[model samples]
Target: MKDVEDNGLKNDAFLAAAASELEQMVEQICERIGTPLHETTELQRQVLAAFGFGAVYSITHRDRLTEPQAHALSIRMLIKPFNYSEQQAVDFVDDLIRVASNEEVHPLMNTIIHRGINGHVQFAQEDYEAMGRNIQEILAAVQQ
Candidate 1:
């Protein structure tokens, strides 16, 4: 019983330290990405709440994505100027809802949004549309 109690305490301390380190790292990453730190933290909380830690960690660390990978992530946002059918748009949203729930990829997907969207104020309708498109594209690619 004593050993178990000690182990539990050690685990708690380790988790606290890890959380602090991750918070700092996230802050730096947000700065480097030109995103607001508060927004990044909020997004992280949302992602964790929605998908749990296991999924988010998996996707972010899975590939060590190259520049091409990063660029691809933003392709949908970039293509927003083009016309899309209503069905296509709805399908895209459905796709995001599906993928964002995946335990393995949700974290990475959330990070992609946190970093890519620049964490500005509530996005306008056009911006939201672009983000939705981006989310759909990202989920499709991740699923593949």
Candidate 2:
């Protein structure tokens, strides 16, 4: 894995302060991603209900991994015995961190991050996004 220059993005204080908000985000994200695949057998969801809960754990460890590594791990850990292309796995991770990672990439995605940025702030959404970035880069960002 490539080593990103440590910029000081390790402080998860924002997450600690925004537990409820994160939880709510997890619930909605997990529900959307964990739905049963109609094309699959068992007439049941693929037991991915744990993704919402499990993803945060994986995401928090982003500092220890490269973006590519994180994406690969996301694929391996996210889907179980079920088969999905590497793209799907990669996209899945991208979708999660993307919102918080880059606000300018898409304006709509920034809605949550922009919520009262200067007043009555609920959370440090940028830090949440930084959590998904390269460890070294994150270090520098956090240091700022």
Candidate 3:
């Protein structure tokens, strides 16, 4: 019981910190790119949907799910909420990982961090550009 409580606290802290950092990064990227973040686009919607599942499942599973597990959960989420075909959901998640994180292995595939109940977000640089390149690419892809 004690261990469960402690672990829950730890994961909550980690997720909160991740979210805050991600928010700041988004703002900085937008500022550097000379545009606000795109809030309503297909890609954005899909990512939000995936992250929404992350937000909930991260709490429910709590350091128990792997990236593949998180990903499988996301597929179901996208399908139900967005009414995406199974293949579309898979592609959306895959494209999300590729275009956003520039990763290959199931995104968080093997991290002990949050038991992979996390997104593989990469702000590769924190310069005058404020990591705008990645954001720019995403915007371009989604035509935002």
Candidate 4:
């Protein structure tokens, strides 16, 4: 019983920390993107939803999850609504992760760090025109 109680306390702490980190990141993203949180487009909101899930999961399991494990989890969340095939999903996720830490992932992604639970995001560049190129490509590919 004591062990279980202790574990519960740890989980609670983990969740609180994750929420705080996510909130701060969201604020930063909104600031960088020059769009308030409420004005986010439907697509942007979808991405945020995935990030939210990934953030919580990664934070809670930070000690146990490998880098690949955390990356895969975020990819799964981001790709969930797309209904891509298993192989296609893996390939796309790989491509996304390959560009995760850099400015190439997606322009909006540039504003928000791709680190699932670490919450360490940096401003890649201040060029708004260059930011959404990746997302535009992804959307174009999906439409076809």
User: In model 4, which regions exceed 4 Å deviation?
Assistant: 51-61, 65-144
TM-score of 1: 0.34
**Residue 108 error, candidate 3, Å:** 20
Per-model TM against the reference: 0.34, 0.30, 0.42, 0.44
State in Å the error of residue 117, model 4.
Answer: 7.7
Please give, for residues 1-144, the per-residue lDDT of candidate 2 as tens digits: 223323223323333333344344433333433433434333122223123323433343533444554444445543433344567655655664665466676543333223322111211243433332222232233246
Residue range 78-137, candidate 3, lDDT tens digits: 565456799998887675555335434445322212222333233423353423453354
Runs of candidate 1 exceeding 4 Å displacement: 39-144
TM-score of 2: 0.30
Tell me the whole-model lDDT of each prediction, alpha carbons only: 0.38, 0.37, 0.49, 0.48
Clashing pairs in 3: none
Q: Candidate 4 on 1-144: residue-level lDDT in tens?
A: 999999878755644454455565555555655666578666665555434443534453654645654555445444443344567667755655544445655655433333333333121233323323433343344346
Q: Which residue pairs in candidate 1 have backbone atoms (N, alpha carbon, C) closer than 3 angstroms, thus clashing?
A: 56-107
Clashing pairs in 2: 4-136, 5-136, 6-136, 7-139, 7-140, 8-139, 8-140, 9-138, 9-139
Top-scoring candidate (TM-score): 4
Q: Backbone clashes per model, in order?
A: 1, 9, 0, 1
Q: Could you give me the TM-score of model 4 versus the true structure?
A: 0.44
Candidate 3 residue 8 C-alpha distance from true site, Å: 0.6
